[model samples]
Target: MFFSPAQIYPFPGTSLAEDPEDIQKEVLENYAKDLPPIYLDVVQHADLSTLIWAPLMFRYPWNVVFGKLSKQNITVAGDAMHPMTPDLAQGGCSALEDAVILGRHIRTSFVQNGQVLVLKNLSEVLGKYVEEKRWHVTLLIMWSYISGWVQQGGSGRGMKFLRDAIFYKFLFLKMVKYVNYDCGKLDF
Candidate 1:
């Protein structure tokens, strides 16, 4: 049986002194009572003692992420470019796509001359990568934030009902169709 994990977000932040086991116990207590056997089994088998904690933070005004995609010959990818909430689970997938797309552009542009390294062509090639990725990442950031907002329980009952009944089933599903994209093969 498939058991989708649920998280209650915007939780009070964890401190260095907080024990992972304690946190795990609290989390399980909150949900285990209502979960089915499969979920309880997962909780039982989980080694919460080894779990590492990190802040669940997202960058607001996503333009900041887009704005820094490319500068001179350097460009950011993955979490460096778009630090997003995990609601959509696209963060790592998008990063891997970025690498492939960037590699393709670099191979097609800079390596065409058979030169090992071409400093002059670097900027131009990286610019193309940024151009191709900027809008896509922007869309990802915005949608991820919206998805998180809805899942975390929106402003009120009306908003929650709209998100769950209408937005999630219709608009969000359509948006997700665009996420399963192919960056295509890098022929090099």
Candidate 2:
């Protein structure tokens, strides 16, 4: 089974902390106290002067799921296949890439397995899927790690500077590789 929560957002850091007075200062700065009843209701539940802090955690189950659909056995894209830090926003994009790659691999697998696939050929099909997906998926996975590290201030100053100076530009080029996606156009 696969699960994707709707509440996940980009992690600014592992956590945010503020003293009671500072918390009030921020709340006032954000103007949440005047927004509406729906917003103010959350404040009504507790003292506005309390020390409020929210901690962020990146949790990835990284589980694999597969099923056969009319001779097409495959998995759903997303945290089900590869769960990455939300800092990159690529978790979903990575899933899309997985679905594309998997579809391509399955089609090729069927062609190689002949009209009737046997138990022995199952390994061959799955193996090919892994082989084909490894490098491309790995590139995205590494990017996810780098993006998260930089976003959370975990990266060193030099790395952060480099990202600001060069990697940001590099990202646009990378987008081309991702956007020109077509399982059918791929050259095996």
Candidate 3:
């Protein structure tokens, strides 16, 4: 899928009153015109009449104050707890980690409590799950945001230098190192 930034003007030519389809078409045409020949060729022949304009949404990790992710026995996982940019490609992977870690904690509690779901034990299990995942998810969110910013921060000289020189040459290794993280075996 082609991902392109679209500008939404608040005044003059385009307004909220304008038809959404017309705005999408105008934006696509305007942005697609600057594409390199190879990409332009594909866009020109492809059907864009049905193209959908959806806003890419992500919350900065700092926007959320670090606090308890569980209230009593109820808890959250995945995007519900931490929504991040797709640059790191860890959204789904981290969700799976949450599952494994949560399950591990729950399994331990279950086994210790003679396979019965005690409310107090479940609450402690959720707390352990949150404690285990909180910092990891926070780091993932921060790194993903930074990665996206550096990659798509435009063609300015400073940004290009940072993206190409600093990020690619130095920090890329650290960025991908999280992939080696073992969520551990879920077997009981």
Best model per TM-score: 1
> What is the alpha-carbon lDDT for the whole of candidate 3?
0.73
lDDT tens digits, residues 33-101, model 1? 688889888876788677654656656635644366677788888887777778788889989999999
Worst 10 residues of 3 by lDDT: 1-10
Full-model lDDT, candidate 1: 0.72
lDDT accuracy of residue 20 in candidate 1 = 72
Q: Record all residue pairs in model 1 with backbone atoms less than 3 Å apart, i.e. clashing.
A: none
Candidate 1 clash total?
A: 0
Q: Each prediction's TM-score against the native? A: 0.75, 0.49, 0.74
lDDT score for residue 129 of model 1: 87
**Cα displacement (Å) at residue 159, model 3:** 1.0
RMSD for each of the candidates: 6.3, 9.6, 6.6
lDDT of 3 by residue, 1-188 (tens): 11224421121233342455555556547767787888877655555565545544656465334766898989989898878877888989988998999999999888888888688778889998888888788878777777776787677899799889998998778888965578888996
Give the worst 10-residue stretch by lDDT in candidate 2: 62-71
Overall lDDT per candidate, in order of appearance: 0.72, 0.53, 0.73
